[model samples]
Target: MRPQDSPTRETKRLDGRWHFLADPAGAGRAERWFATPLQARDGVEEMPVPASYNDLTTRPDLRDHIGEVWYQREVRIPRGWAGERILLRLESATHRATVWVGETELGSHEGGYLPFDVDLTDHARAGELVRVSVAVDNRLTWQSIPPGVVEDTDAGPRQRYWHDFFNYAGLHRSVWLHSLPQTRIEDITVLPDLDGDTGLVDYAVEHSGQGSVSVQVLDASGAVVASDDGAAGVIRIAGVHPWEVGEGYQYTLRVTLSSDGEVADVYDQRFGVRTVAIEGAQILLNGEPVYLTGFGMHEDHVARGKGYDDASWKLDFELLDWIGANSLRTSHYPYAEDVMDYADAHGILVIDEAPAVGLNMAIGGGIFGGQGYTTFSPDTANEATRANHAQVLTELYQRDKNRPSVIVWSIANEPESDTDASYDYFAPLFAHMRSLDSRRPVGYVNVMLSPYGKDKLAGLCDLYMLNRYYGWYVDSGDLDNAMLHLRDELGQWAQDGKPILMTEYGADTLAGLHSLDGATWSEEYQQDLLEATHAVFDEVEEFVGEHIWNFADFQTTKGIMRVDGNKKGVFTRDRRPKAAAHRVRERWTRIRGRA
Candidate 1:
């Protein structure tokens, strides 16, 4: 859970080819597939772990399969891990997963984007072959977090959801086999604050066995700047360098657990000395007003389909730097931990969001569909959905609480916040988020349908995050009316006296498509829409940020509204720059220079 490694810890990546089988009839569990080798079963194929099975296969049946799938692989325990506590860790396992070692069930987990580990110390011996089987289910119901429904069609089962993106699911992250000491550190929390010229780091350590904990704060040069001896205490450093926007200054906090005068475990955590506060109509980072300029991104690419690719990940940050942007929101779900590390090292701000999208049933047809039904009914997104949402928020906070780049915790994206039922649903969730971590601002992305007068949950939020599609979804190719409507909405929201961030605003632009005049779906149109939106953003004094709708084109559910996929990206899906990318770069560069 804590970045996976330290001096007393070791990890091995179980991320190669594995035997896979799709159980569209839901017969895996009844057939006892986990008890024997998957090769003995029919229709089994070799598939790559840490990648979605949907896009990897050539068969359409496997691509759109709607039920449980099984993955089996053999792992050998290292001889050096004889006396250590060995564990099997999955970085992510789609919507839900159940694990099995040999014939015994290890455990089960529900959330898709977070990590979970199963202890294998008592099951396997050193230097022995162990068979690991995992069954992953991609179905989503009213009780699920990002709720959806599966309908049986004439051909097969069809998966339907309210969100605009494709539901590509599998083991979309790495699988790890790690070893830890018998008496080791379980969790470490580092909360850094600033007082004048001094840096105060409040720390806490949770260990498994009895031990004496000591902490040392090391600077960038690996020199000890402060030291403390306790399970929980504060360490002060004089003349501290604050971690600023576009300038990442990190200090390492090394924690050591000693028992019987011998070293039990050593873990080092990286932290930045900074604080986030909301004052009047400004969101301040370390007491300075910081504007967010980036995109609402997804962990999606060609072939991988929500799977984590290191090359694509690195190129994304490189492109963000090229565009002179400062921040981004993990739009719908929590991203991989390594991505957070990259943002932390590069000084890019993050709006950490939960996987609470598509809570409204009125727009199940799409964002531009009808809106009559209530969003929070017993058969739809009801109390069960709220419980799952709360669990994800807790997991998200526990994972990324110490990171300095996380400035805001977005609860949901574009829910039906105008309805009275929505108010009852989201109000407690916002309060729950605050109870988890009050240091950062907590709010949800408001849909265009939920205007200032109709919205009820706005009063509960610390700040406002609006996803307005003025020229695209609302006004439709009329820039003049779109800008007018955008300004009017901002004027109404500005009256609330809270910092407002435009979390989404852009047009779908096909690459190389041009017109003499700005036409819809043309590259010129995308550029003009962004520039016009920026003009409006500058007019609103409460506007603190503007992250475009998407960073790149990504696949979505098949429909008449999509051409291949969403083309709102400033760049193509393969990472090619469009005309809008250059325009954004020019504007953000000036903004960064001014700051």
Candidate 2:
């Protein structure tokens, strides 16, 4: 599993310019673009693959578009892949996606954060030119996970969600055409545990056709440390070295599928032998207590929007290393899978989250209005939304269950958990998540409502992950009041007898603005707010962690309240440190020394 080693299966990349057309009126279906030849189409524009169509151009209309968008590309199948099973895999397409090859319909997927595949073996032929059409709908409805309403405004229709980030949509990740044998390895699940220095790995291999599976666990030096000859079983390696923060140790599990003595497919699943546990209000890693420190980040940037940017992430890691941070919460949603892999390789702790943001009915009315609003329930009783939420959680679990970097699973972010209906909605989800993976602690990023009101659903989580904007959102510019409020809330939460992580707390600072009196949108105000919160943290014994509100500035729906997106990042959108960054670096460095 080195970068230089080629994959056993052949893959053709389809990640360049594709013919794009905005279908606000839903005319693409009436016109039958899937059945029509590309050459005969009109009004088609070229847009890059793996990019958010919102940020790809200078057109304001396209940037704020909220409807179905059509993308078409022509690809030729390799002759060698004729007899093999062909599949079109998209790393992600926002909201919903319908795919088609020529006149044949391939299937559609609902969720946007996880990968989806369409089997093309029956619809496509080798060495032939095939037209692939993808229809992506970015509109949000009340039934969506991040529930919102489409309202008719002066500017046609506006798409708004309860979340505080821009709804950037398109093919935000890579797409590829993979060719595999008919009897190929579908998936591999590796659950690693530790018995002192020895590593016990419980594994299961899934396949398409009947086969005998053999697994080999290779150590860091490419030495075979353990082996098994069944599709489902466990293997143990003596003298195993556990993975630690900033140490980045990994082992490769090579799963070989053979049908009647003929090699069918070989797959590699990399994992780290580590254990995460919560023992009596302490978060333990490898049986040792560890405190979390980092930011709740987004997959966002100025030019790329929500599209996955490798350079941004590399710079982000460098910044995190400089800030002496060891962990981060994938705030509000699950990031790209490559991010999880990078965290595993670099030894950063992750709180893997789902795209379950905006499950609230109270917010989303332009910032100034939604303040103090009540009844923000995300209709957990709706059977369809609940079913979809469960499926999304299942997919998120299956995708990242083996990554050692992921120690916790965040089921939701700031949902309507203060009401009785909230309990009905979250209890089933909490149970489903627990049943899916028992290795990680499952919780939601509770909002300020949990502390201010009755947290009827707080018992659903193993840990209390709270998000509060006391000074900025409530008593503005009053650090004294903020400290008093934070102390009272933290004291209240500690009484629950659970490890508490102050998952989010920060002020929106316009990068360089200064204020002698500590007013809002000033660097001084942001610094003071955080310092006050940290001061309270020192007094609270149960405060296990504090992740800043944002890793960097990110886009959001246009509003007078947001000065060109949310500007709460310690770092600017260009990945440059603001004044608050220096204070954070200093505080974190001192904390790291004590740690």
Compare the candidates by lDDT and give the number of the best one: 1
Worst 10 residues of 1 by lDDT: 365-374
Which residue pairs come into collision in candidate 1? none
User: TM-score per candidate, in order?
Assistant: 0.98, 0.95
Give a tens-digit lDDT track for model 2, residues 161-265.
778888889998888888888888888888888998899999999898888999999998999999999999989989997888877799999989999889888
Deviation of model 1 at 167, angstroms: 0.4
Clashing pairs in 2: 361-376, 362-376
Query: Tens-digit lDDT track for model 1 on 308-362?
Result: 9899899999999999899999989999998999989878999999988888765
Give the root-mean-square deviation of each candidate in angstroms: 1.4, 2.4
CA displacement after TM-score superposition, residue 109 of candidate 2 (Å): 0.5
Alpha carbon lDDT at 219, candidate 1 = 94
Candidate that would win on TM-score: 1
Question: What's the lDDT for residue 581 in model 1?
Answer: 94
